[model samples]
Target: MGNLDKDILEKIDDWLSSSYDEETRASVQKLIDDQAETELIDSFYKDLEFGTGGLRGIMGVGSNRMNKYTIGKATQGLSNYLIKQFPNQEIKVAVSYDSRNNSQSFGQLVAQVFAANGIKVYLFNELRPTPMLSFAIRHFGCKSGVMLTASHNPKEYNGYKAYWNDGSQLTAPHDKNVIDEVNAIASVKDIRFEGNTQNIIPVGEEIDPIYIEANKALSIHPEAVQAQKDLKIVYSPIHGTGITIVPKMLASWGFENVTVVTEQATPDGNFPTVIYPNPEEEDAMALAKKKGEEIDADLVLATDPDADRVGIAVKNSQGQFQLLNGNQIGSLLIYYVLSAKSDLKQLGNNPYIVKTIVTSNLQADIANHYHVAHYETLTGFKYIGELMTKLGDSAQYLAGGEESYGYLVGDLVRDKDAPNSCAFLAEMTAYFKSKGKTVYEVLLDIYQEFGCYQEKLISLTKKGKAGAEEIQAMMAGLRQNLPTTLGGIEVKEIRDYELSQTTDMKTGRKSEITLPKSDVLQFITVDGDVISARPSGTEPKIKFYCSVKGTLHDKSDYLSLQNTLEEKVDRMMKDIVG
Candidate 1:
């Protein structure tokens, strides 16, 4: 009791006295009754800040955690904003969730809150991918949408992702405006907890077919798929919502030899297979990779819990299964989609593509080779979705991706889509197989054509109050003391995204960055190396992205050249943060 802070005690008391259910209230009271100071402080330290994207944290009964009350408040606030924004409208919203511990319950809570506020809700009947929620919003012409997921976070974590009518997450004025509204709900009494069952419509069976049908039309090479229909394909959902649709998406594209990793196929919030359910982690995709080896599969794919991002493994030149980093997968996806379409002389008018600034520049090079317009958005897929909506009717979107294994194809969904990516990726593999090539060979060819591009991401997680402060201090130190050189290359330019300014190191000339403000820093070397450091918006971590270039005139030099670039990038990162 002595260690518990005064403010934390007050917050705990509020929850205890509020209309929270007996279990929830008892959970909160137990901490106080047992004199659990540290646990109590951690839970009640501060209200989980609903960031630009939405709420995410450990699930528990406290202000600083993800619980029914916090999610309900966010829903009530979003409902208020929707009603105000679309006056005299039906005010429909799409609600879906992943298989996280409380995702289904949280999704129900969201539907109930929205329904209580006189908003029509189309909720998923079962766990579904995050992208499907985006698709539902567009298909139903809803005013907004919310998905209950933490993407690839750990088992204890859950989150909320809010989307706009255009099928994209909130951007610009809307993001800040929604934050304002969420903050305006100063008390639990202000939230509408009771739900109107009439207003909550269970949806999914009708939407899945439409989503699968829409994804099938994105295939650029049906003949190739037909020719190589027996392509060995292995995939795992990592116990997320991907199993619900990925296989169907693949089958819809004419893939006949698809194998599912049975052990990791079920939708379990506990994510018992791997420590972190993220496909980005090798252990998480281990089952799929092993299955690929057992069958000597042509390719292997795994999606995160929400199925918006995918991780893939292909046979390298050595005939061994190798996992493709996000950059490589995204680059190949763009290359195959654009090249196949461009080669067939089907380049549509105003063809456009997108990637995050931290992603590989090879994507931009590929876009340029086909004379397609490309734009670099800030780090989030929401920004890409926002740009797509901004360029509506004027520019046709071909594809867009980030380095974090998230990619979207066509204009079907406004978010990064894994199920859609799986369909296209399998199709891309089939097309390559039809050409007597492997996915790795095409990647090497792309490197041979566009020079070898290598990029690496390193994230440092600092948790809780002290960790947050340490992250801020590290950024401040780096900002105040800019490195003169990294990886033995001269620093040519430094871009401060927070200040929206890019300054040339030599001439000391500063240019304006047109994108919105963000806390990011980039240092470009004279030798075509762009190293960026930015903090994660969702998780408590800082990510360092190192992109380097080298010549790959000979395919035999792929492994050595790649290793050299990796060490160089390591040295470059070492100079800055280590």
Candidate 2:
């Protein structure tokens, strides 16, 4: 450990002298004795800051890692925040954990710290989905909540997602304030790891019934699901927490012919079946698609590790199983919701739809077809939740979704709930089947009614410290040298969300954008194509979202039109980067 600073060296020494296990101490000692400069530097570089996604890192023993000490400090900070927020009342908080490595232990640590601070804690008895934690916070009338999960990250990671009483993740002043408290806790000694056993409550069946009943209430077409009760649906959880309740929820929705992918059904943190447990990953859904093909199922749905995001596969025009991208699924869900509500004459004139700025604009097209309002917020489910809170009383929120496969059916819960989405998606498939059409056919019909909108997401990951700097520089370069055109089309409007302004290149006219400032840039072409560039908040990567649209005159031309749109997206990306 040559050239190691006194502070880092002393921190390691303190861990060695503290109550940390012997194995962790021995690993630190071995690194010190071997003079492993790189390992020591990486381990002791800096404390892992509570990011937008809360504390997420590889499970290990270090200031920058996710371990008992870090989790404890975070919980203590949250407990402090809760106390400050609710000074007079008796504060209670709900806690849940996913099926990740160390998730349960970390959850218990949180509950213990909260209980030690004289706060009531309702901790889930075992592994549970993240959305249920969100739901429980509102249902149990808690002041705050914490979910122990790394979301769709790999097995080496774990996380803590802090929530307010609104059932959404912290935002604005609260998020920064909680971070300040966590940062103020400079030492593990500041954390209270012991608890009054009476204050820590383990919750399971008592709350399960409530969550399932609420999810069932989100069903837009129970009669449709009842009619198509035997609709063949293949489901998988990708070895995460979804399997616990998703199948049961489907059965309750009257879908009796659901097939669970046995290989990926069990909850294992190792995620032995796939490299990434994220439903966005094709490898994770390969088995489900295989089962779909064998059984000729109507739809194949899989949720992410925490069950917050759901991805589905539908048979295309050729009767081959094809995965619908996040944008496609978002459009279909929005289309069905809006169309069904309009058909039933249940839509209020003040009804509105919410979607993240990064999501497909096809939703906007559909919303316009029904004369419903639509609003776009920053790139987070929390912002959508905030809007729902803001407009809950005056304007009705029909539905909202993001480009990342997260959707909210109603305002019952404040987060993207896969359990509810899974049931609703199954109902959508059945509804189309009742109308003598496949889900793919409904999607095509929507496209034919609107235009054929195709979207592509390209994420370029820049890992580690140096990669972070590189990404920053790239964003700066784009802002400095804004492109005048893309894909041979004139860049008519440039929407710079950071500066909260839209500039017309030709007229040199600038106007204000009213949404919250984010590091996203959108270039709209004269031919009605959109290209957006944004950097990831939680991870070290930058993503570019490209959208191109055209008309599909017939179902036979779907594949050819899709290919053209793909080419348009590719050319646009190249022009922007080049």
Candidate 1 lDDT tens digits, 5-68: 7898788888888467889999987887888877788788888887899998988889989998
Weakest 10 consecutive residues of candidate 1 by summed lDDT = 12-21
* Top candidate (lDDT): 1
Off by over 4 Å in 1: none
For residue 312, model 2's alpha carbon misses the true position, in angstroms, by 0.6
Every candidate's lDDT: 0.92, 0.88
Cα shift from native, residue 44, model 1 (Å):
1.7
lDDT of 2 by residue, 423-485 (tens): 889999999899999988998898888999999888887865567788989999999999988
In order, how many clashes per candidate?
0, 1
Q: Tell me the alpha-carbon RMSD of every candidate.
A: 1.1, 1.8
